[model samples]
Target chain A: MDSLTDKIRTLCTGLLKDGKVDMIVGFKKGTIPMSSCPCVARTPEQAKELIWDSNCTLNLANYLTNRKEKIGVVAKGCDSRNIVNHIIENKVTRENLYIIGVPCDGMVDKRKIRALFNDDITLFSEENNKLFVETASEKKELDKQDFLKNNCTTCIHRNPVIYDELAADPVEEQKIENRFADVIKIENMSSDDKWNYFNDLIKDCIRCYACRNACPLCYCPTCFVDESNPQWVGKGQDINDVRTFHLLRAYHCAGRCTDCGACEEACPMDIHVRAFTRKLVKDSCEIFDWEPGLDPNKRPALDTFNPDDPDGFIK
Target chain B: MKVIKIDKQNWTGGIDKSRENYQIFGPVKDKEHFVFKKLNLKEYPDMENALSVLSPKSILFPQSEKILAASLDESQDDHHIMKRVATDYSPRAVIGIMPCDAKAVQLVKLNFDTDDYRDPYWCDAYEATTFVGLAVNKPSIYDFTLSMGSGPFAEEGLDVLLVDCKDHFLAKVLSEKGDAFLKASGFTSEADADKSAKLINEIKNQAEKAIDAEKVKTEKLKEKSLLELHGASFWEDLSFSCINCGTCTFVCPTCWCFDIQDETKGKKAVRFRNWDSCMSPLFTLHASSHNPRAEKVQRVRQRFMHKLKYFVDKYDQGTMCVGCGRCVVHCPVNIDIREICNTMNSYEAEQA
Candidate 1:
C-alpha cells in the first residue's frame, strides 16, 4: 500500500507539473488514525501528501459535479463507475477529467472495528490482509476479510470500468451467488413487518442529510427536501417525514446508483442506508436487465424507453 | 461540599427510589450507541458507558419542539393568533451526563437565557431539571475538555459530580439541588470529606493528564482580527472535504441553531422549532430567494468561524465548544475541530 501511495503521488505530481490539470483530488492522511480525508492538491508539494489506504471510503466523484476545471481525480472501482454516470448525465465532461484509477480490494468498516473495543482505538494499521488494532487495554490482530464493509464484501467490481491511468495491477473480482439475498429477505417479509423493519432501520436518523450529501448522484442545486414553496418533505424528525425523505431519495436514484456504499459510510448514525438503494439496484437489474455506469454513451434504464421493457408493474 | 459514598449494592436501589420523586433520564444502550432516554422502573443509567452518541442537550433543547401553534378554523376565539404551546415542565434529573456536556449546557445558556431576552421553552425546561454529571476517569483519545477550559472532573454546571471508584461511586454534592436529590434517593451515607477530596483529586489529575497533550492554543486568536482569520487562505483547503451536511453540528453539544416551520393537518396548524445547522444550504437563505452563504465553502467557514471566532469575540467565552469530541468522532469526512482550532489560533496573515 505504501508503494501504491508513492506511485499515486508521483503520477499526480507529474500531472500537476505538466499543467495537465488545475488540481488533483485525492485522499490525505487524516489527523486521527484509520481516517483518510478527501483533499485537493494544486501544487507538486501538496500532491506529495496524497495517500492510498483502506480508509479512503468516500466517493471522489462527488467532487466532480459540474466542475469546470480540468481536474485529475483518484478513483476506485465505485468512484470510476460514478464518474461514468456523471459523464452520461452531463455533470462533468470527459475531456476535462484525468481519472487515475485504483484497483480496490475493499474498505474496512470503522463501525465494526469500533464496536470491538470498549475504549477508543489508539492505533490501527493494515498490511496485506491483516488488521492490527490496539487500545489502551488490549491489542488484537484480525482478518481484513472479516471486517470488510457490507457492500464491499458482496461487490463484484474490483477493477475500474474506465480510467486514464492505472495505479496497480487489477485484482480478481468476487463471484457472489446470491447478491440480492438481503433484499430478498426483506421482500419475503409481510407488509406490516416490512413497515416495522424500515421504521426501525431509520428511527435513529437525525436528518443530518449526510447520506444524501455523500452520494455522487445527489448533485441537485436545490434538493427536493430544501424546496420551500411546495416542500416535498418536512424539516423535522417526525417518523413520517424521515420515511418520506429516505424513500423519495431512493426513488430518485432508481437506475443511476452504482452501490458505491459512500452513503452508508458517511452516515453518522451507522444506518445501513443501502437497504433502500439495494432494492432499487436489484429492481433495475431484474426488470430492465441493466447495470448502471457500465457505458458512458448509454442512457440509464429509467431515463430511456424500450418496447421490451417490463411494464407489468405499471398496473 | 459534601461527598456521599454510594455503595454499588445500594446504587440501583437509590436510583429506583429517586424515580418516585423525579423523572430519571440517563444513558441507556440504544442499539449500537448509548443515548439519554427516560428510564423505566428498573433501568439504571449505564454509568460504565462512554459518552452518548448525542449529547444530553436534547433534554433542554429537543431536536424538534413546538414553540407556538395556531388554528385556521374561524370557530375558535384565537383563530389565526398564534399562542404558546403546552409542554411538560415536570421535575426531572439527567443522570450520568458527561462533564463537558454539562458545561456545554451553560455555554448554550448564553444564547437561550440572556439578560435582554429569555427563550421561554429552554428556560422552562432548564429550570425544571437538575444536571447530575458523571466524571470521566478514563478519557478517550478524542476528549479535549481540559484544553477547552473544562476538565473530565470539572464541576462547573453540574448539581453533583459522580465519580466511579471501582466498587462504589463518590458523589460530590455541589448545590442545594444536589442535596435535595440525594435526600430523595435515600443516599445519606456520607464519606470523610478530606480523604474523599484527596482521592478525587488524584483521579482528576490522572484523567486530565491523559488529555493534557491535546491542548490547542487559542490565545493567538484573541490577538488576530476577525476579518483576518475569516479571510485566511487556509479556509478552502481546510473545508474541501465538507459535504455540507449537518453531521458535525447535530452531534455537537454546543451547536444551538434552529429553524421554525409550521405544519398543517386539516384545520389545525402547529409551529415547530427544528434543529438547524449552518452546514445546510438554506441556513442563511432569505425570503427573497437570495442566499448569502450559498457556496459550500462559505457554509463550512461559518460553522468554524462562529464556533472559534464569533462566539469568542462576542461572549468572551473561551470558545463556544466544550471539546466533548462528539463532532470529531462522528464527522463522516473526518473534519476535525481540533485541527481547525489549532489552525485558526496559529494563523498569521501575510502582510500586504
Candidate 2:
C-alpha cells in the first residue's frame, strides 16, 4: 500500500511539474479511519500529498465533469469507465484528460467495520490483505476479503477499461455468476411486494441528493427535483415522494450506470441505494446485451436504441 | 435544580406513561445506525450508541415538512389557495437527544424564531417538544463540541440532562418542563441534591478533560477580520473533493437552509419545506440565470463563513455551528471543519 501511494505521488508530481497537465486529481489520507479524500494539485508540491489505497472508493470521474483544463486524474476501474461515459456525452474532451489508472482491490466498508467491532474503532490499519482494528482497549485482525465492500465483491471489472498510464499491473477479474442475486430476490417478489420493498428501503432518505450529486453521469443543468414548471414530485418526506425520487433517479442511469457503488458510497444514510440501480444494470444486460463504457465509439444502451430492439415488455 | 433517580427496570414504564399524554420520540436502532423515531410501547432507545446518522434537529425541523395544503379543484371555493395543514401541536418529548444536538436546536432557533418573520412550522414544533439530553460518557474522536462552545453535558437548550449509571439514570431536571415530564412519568424517587450534584461534576470534569486533550481551534476564529478570512485563498483546496452534495447540510444540526415548494399530489395541493444546502449550485441559482455564488469555491466559503463568522457577527452571539461532528464524519470527501476553522482563525492579513 505504501509503495503504491509513493508511486502515484511520483507520477502525479512529474505530470504537474512537466506542464503535461495543468492539474493532478487523486486521493489523500482522510482525517477519519478507513477512507481517503479526493485531492486536486496544481503544483508539484501539492501533488506530493496524493496517496493510494483500498479507501480510494469515491469515483474520481465525478470531478471530470465540465472540466476545462487539461489535467491528470487517478482512476480505478469504475472511475475509468465513467470517464469514458463522460467523454461520450461531451461533458469533457478525451484530449484534455490524462487518466492514470489503477487496478482495484475493493474498497473497505467502514460502516461494516464499525459494526464488526460494535464500538468505537480507535485505530485502524490495513496490511497483508487483512484489517487490524483497535478499539478503546482491545485489538483484533480480520481477513480483508470478508470485509470487502459489497459492490467490490460483486464487481466483474477490476481493471480500468482505458488509461494513459498504468500505476501497476492489472488485477485478475473476479468470476461470479450470482452478481445479481440480491436484485433477483426483489425481482422474484410479487409486484406489490416489490413496491413495498422499495418504499421501505428508501423510507429514511432525507432527499439530500448525495446519491444524485455523487454520480459521474448525473450532470444535468437543472435536476428534475428542482424543476418548478411542472413539479414531478413534492418536496415532502412522504414515502411516495421519497420513493419517486429514488426510482426516477435510478431510471436516469438505466443504461449509463457502471455499478461503481459511488452513489451508495456517498449515501450518508447507508441506504442500499444500489438495490435501486443494480436492477437496471441487470435488465440492460439481459435485454440489450450491452455493457456500458467498454468502448469509446459505442454509446450507452438508452442513448441509441436499435429498430430491432426487443418489444417483449411493450406488448 | 430537581434531582431524581429512576431504576433501570422501571424506565420503560415511565416512558410508556408519558406516551399517553405526549408523542414520545427517541433514538431507535435502524438497520446499521440509529435514528430519532417515534417510539412504540415496548421499543427502547439506545443512548449508548454512536451519534444518530442525522442529528436530532430533525425532531423539531424535519427534512421535509408539509406546511400548507389546499384543493386544486376549479369548482371548489378556495381553488389555488393554500391553508395551514392542521398539525398536532400537542406537547411531545424527545428522549436521548445528545447535548450538542440540543445546543444546535438553540443555534438554529436564531433563524426560525427571530424578531422578524417567524417560520411557524419550526416555531410550533420547537414549542411543542421538550428536549431530553443524554450526557456523553465517551465522546467520539470526531467530536469537538468543547471548543464549539457546547460540551457533552452542556445545558443550553435541554430541559433534562441524563447520566447513564449502568443500573439506573441520574436525571438533572433544569426547567419546569422537565419537572412536569418526570412527574407525569411517575418518577417520585428524589435523590440528595448536593451528592447528585457532586457526582455529576465528577463525570462532567472527567469527560471534559478527555475532550480538552484533543483541542480543535475555535476561539481565535472570532478575532479574525471577515475580509482577510474570506480572501484567504485556501478554500478551493480545502473543498477540492467536495461533490457539492447535501449530506453535510442535511445531517447538520445548525444548517437550517430550506426551500419551499408547492406540489399537487392527486387532488391535494400541498406546500412543503425541504432541507437545502448552500454547497449545491442550484441553491443560489437565480430566476434571471445570474448567480452571485455560482462557483463551487464561493459556495463552499459561504457555508463556513455563515456558520463561523456571519452568524457570529449578525447575532452578536457565538458561531452558528454546534460542532456535533456529523459533517466531519459523513462528508464523502472528509472535509473536516476543524481544519477549516483553524485556517480561518490563524490566517494573517498581508502586510499593508
Candidate 3:
C-alpha cells in the first residue's frame, strides 16, 4: 500500500512538472477525523499531500463535470467507467482529461469500520497489508479483506475502463453475476410485504435531500417539484406525496443510474433507497443488455429513442 | 354584463338544474377546510364560503395521466410491437376557479403553445376545458401579491366571470363560450353602469387589502450576497430538524418537476410522466453513481435559489411564492421558507 502511495506521488509530481495537466484531483487527509476528502493538487509539491488507501472510496469523477480546466484524476475501475459514461453523455470532453487508472481490490466501508469499534475509533491507518484502528485506550489490527465495502466484494471490473496512465499492477476481470441478490430477494416477496418493507424504510425519511444534492446526474436548472404555477404535489406529509417522491426518483434512475451507492451512503435515515435502484439496473440489463457508465461509445437509453421501444400501458 | 338574483337558498337548485348536462366541479366542505370536488347538489351544500385547498388547474393539467402505451411480442413474427391510440378528452366546465388560478392556466397555455415546442398532452386537455373564474370578495388563504400579481377578475381566456356582491352576483361574459353557456342556462339581465361601478370598486378594494396583508418584506434579504451566505450556519440550524420527506414541494401550488416511466405487463408497455423533485438524492444521480450536490445544505439552497433566483431569471416573474403558508404549516419540523427569507434579510441588514 505504501509503495502504491509512493508511486502515485511520483507520477502526480511528474505530471505537474511536465505541464501535462493543470490540476490533479485526488484524496487528501480529511479535516474531520478519520475521513478522506477530495483535494486538488496544483503543483508538484502539493502532490505530497495526496493519499490513497482502503479509506479512499469516494467516486471523484463528480468534480470533473462543469469544470473547464485540464485535469488529471485518479480513477478506480468503477470511477473510470463513470468518467467514460460522462464522456459519452457530453458532460466532459475526453481530450481535456488525463486519467490515472488503479487496479482496485475494493476499499473499506468507513461506516462499518467505525461501527465495529463502537463509534469511538478516532484514527486509523493501513500498513503491512493490515488495518490498525485506534480507540480511546486500545488499538486493534484487522485483516483488510474483512472491512471491504459490499460493492467492492463482487466487483467484476478490477481494471480501469479508461486510463492515460496506470499506477498499479492490473487484475484480470471477473465474470459478472447476479450482484443484486439481496434486492431481488425482497422484490420477490408479496406486494403487501414489499409495501411494508418500503413503508418502514420511507417513514424514517428526514427530507434532507442529501441524496439528490450528492448525485452527479441530477443537474437541472429547474426541477418540477419546485415549480408553483401548476404544483403537482402538495408540500405536506401525505403518504401519497412521499410515495411520489421515492417512485419518481427510482423512475428517473431507471436506465441512467450507475449503481454507485452514493445516495444510500449519504442518506441519514439509512433507507435502502438502492433496493429500488438495483431493481431498475437489473431490469435495464435484462431488457436492453446495457449497463450505464460501462462504455463511452453508447448513448443513454432515456436520451436515445426507438420508434419500436416498448409501450403497453395506454388504453 | 348581467346582475342575476338567485337567492342563496335557490343557488343549490340552480347548480343541480345545470348538472343535467355539464359536469359541475366546485368547492365542498372537507373536514375543517374546503377542497375542490365533483359537485353534486345533494352532497355539496356550500358555494360562497372559502377557496378550496387545491386549485382548479388539475382538471386541465391532470395530476397523472397516461401519454402512450404499447405491446411487444418477441414470439410473433420477429418481435412485433403494437401501440394504442391516445386518450380522448371530453369538454368539461370547471366552476369557482380563482382569478390567480385562471391566470395560471393562461400562463400554461402561452408557454405550452407559442414555443414551436408545445406540450401537446397539456394543450389537448386544456382545449377541452372551459374556465369559469370566480372573483374573490374577501381574503382567503393565499395572499396573492406575495406570489401572483394582484387581480380579482380575468382579463382574457375566461369563459364566464362570476363577481359576488353582498346582494346579488354580476356575471360577465368574456368569450363566445360564456355567452353561449348563459343563453343555454336560460337566465339573463343586462348590467347597468351603476352595478358595474360597484362591482369594480369591491374587487379593487378586496385585492388591495389582500396584497397589503401578505406582502413579503424582501428588500433587506435582496441586498445580501446570496453566494456568500451559501454555507451560513442558518441553513444547518434550519435543516437540522427536517425529515427530508419532500412534503413541502409536493404540496406547493407552483412545484412542477416530473419523471417519465415505462410500465410493462404481459408484453404490454406504456410510457408515462409523473412529478419529481430536487430534494431527492436520486434526482441528480448519474448512471456512474456520482453525485455533485451531496450535502443537505446544497439541497436546501437549491429550493430557495430556484424559487427566488432561477425561476425569476427564466420567467419574467418575481416572488415565486404565493404566501399560502402551506409549506410552513405542512412541514413536519416547521421549516418555513418565509422565516428563512426573513432571517436572511435581517442578517443582510445587520451586515449592511
The most accurate candidate by DockQ is 1
Candidate 1's DockQ is 0.86
Worst 10 residues of 3 chain A by lDDT: A221-230
Per-residue lDDT for B126-214 in model 3, tens only? Answer: 77666666776554433443334435553445788777766656677777766665554544556775768586677767666655543
Distance from true location, Cα of A123 in model 2, Å:
1.9
Q: Sort the candidates on TM-score, descending order.
A: 1, 2, 3
The candidate that wins on TM-score is 1
The 10 consecutive residues of candidate 1 chain B with the worst lDDT sum are B212-221
Clash list (residue pairs), candidate 1: none
**All DockQ scores:** 0.86, 0.73, 0.03
Once model 2 is optimally superposed onto the true structure by TM-score, how far is the C-alpha of residue A197 displaced, in angstroms? 1.3
Which portions of model 1 miss their true places by more than 4 Å?
A: none
Give the worst 10-residue stretch by lDDT in candidate 3 chain B: B141-150
lDDT of 1 at B291: 90
Q: Rank the candidates by DockQ, best first.
A: 1, 2, 3
Binned by DockQ into CAPRI classes (incorrect, acceptable, medium, high), candidate 1 is high
